[model samples]
Target: MAKISIPTRTLNDGYQMPWLGLGTWPLQGRQLTDSILAAIELGYRLIDTASRYGNEDAVGAAIRESGLPREDFFVTTKLAGRDQGKPYVREGFSASLERLGLDYVDLYLIHWPLPLLGRYVESYVEMVALQQEGLIRSVGVSNFLDDHIAAIVAATGVQPAVDQIQVSPTHAQVDVVEAVSRGGTVVQAWRPLERNGGILEHPTVTGIADRLGVAPSQVVLRWLIERDITTTPHSSNPDRQRLNADIFEFSLEPADVAAITALDVGAPVKQDPKTWEEF
Candidate 1:
């Protein structure tokens, strides 16, 4: 069988990123390593993890065992909110690199923009310094609103390469998507499958699934892909992993697209984008 190629998009920082990555969040121990190895063996080049996930060591072990040269893969990790200070930010990046067993990360994102502490600007300055030091290839933020992103760019003069937020069929962030795209940043969705809150059972999604002869997951992933957004759907099962990676073959019709777009209820099932005060 021929291995499929994951689509790539150029970041605002001039680096290319694979649109589909294996999100290693919640998987731990042998399960994490096993999933990473399976993902790589199945042609996944991008792997997303974080210090908060507590599975970087497993991810690193899998990469080292794969024996694919370091440059062949892309690694992304984020700094936690508590590690947002200047000195702590630098230290945190270094620690993450040690855990990932790499010299530098392809993309380093600020996990969350905790406005209450008012340290994201300083944390971004640290990211700029790390980029200058050759510690990180690109920089970006997650869960930031339009105003927050604008403020950061105004202060740093270096636009983020990406803005990762919770974007699915239901909690579609239209305004944030348009604003960030206008700013030349790639918008990535964390939970592309809608966090399993019966999104697969939704009548509208199932309707499209039935018409297109694809699973609800495939329908959702294709919808996000058509919108020109990057997505990382996590799964421990090899079948689901391959299914998630198999969405590039077919295309969704314009009417199907309209139907999925119309399913927007404008409410977050897991994390509320409006009052993202906690994280």
Candidate 2:
């Protein structure tokens, strides 16, 4: 893959975040460390992990071994559903920092809404306190809807810096994207390639990929970037990692973007934020 210039988006808190990142989920031990190291070597500056992912320790090890200055990377981790609540929020952040072997994380997020528990707001408030204490640089949420974000801001008067949610060509999430953008909050897409189960094989994606002479995954990721949304696609393969980041070399025309936008199926792949209470 050809080297491409990575882009960055300014968070509401004035922090610059790489528009593309390496997602580490369901990866642990040597595989996790190796993949992270490879991603860094492939020019991935942002690393996304979660307490539930159980790989922060490995992520920390890889970063430390990379010999790169701490400031050279953007690390993001999340508060698990099981760790929701004001007290646990602090404990979770501390634990994540310790596991990552870092003094502060670039961005900290509530992994889910868990609205039934009625503690997400409480947890976010505590995250705000951690941000003030310099333990967390910027605070945000994941798998959150527009109202969830609105409620947090309405209560604490502090808008989240980013809202990481599921977005792709099939699951466009237009409303959520617009909502976050309206608030000056950056939208980060998780599971960006798994939309509707087999996005890469979808006719729209494959057609565009064939036309662009790039992998289907690259087309999907580039489409997301073209929409100004941040994304972190996980891949243990070095070639795929490089392919995911090489999207900057070409531009997707407006017609292609519109055609992909027309592929929205109007449903999420899994785990609707409104009802999901998984811990």
| Candidate with the greatest TM-score versus the true structure | 2
Where is the poorest 10-residue window by lDDT in model 2? 1-10
lDDT of 2 by residue, 1-279 (tens): 444467888888999999999999889988999998988888898999999999999999999999999998999999999889977888888899999999999999999999999999999999999999998999999988888998999989988999999888878888779977688788999988883368889888899899889999999999998899999999999998898998887879999898888899887657888889778
Candidate-wise lDDT, in order: 0.85, 0.89
TM-score of each: 0.95, 0.96
User: Which residue pairs clash in candidate 2?
Assistant: none
Give the 10-residue window scoring lowest on summed lDDT in candidate 1. Answer: 270-279
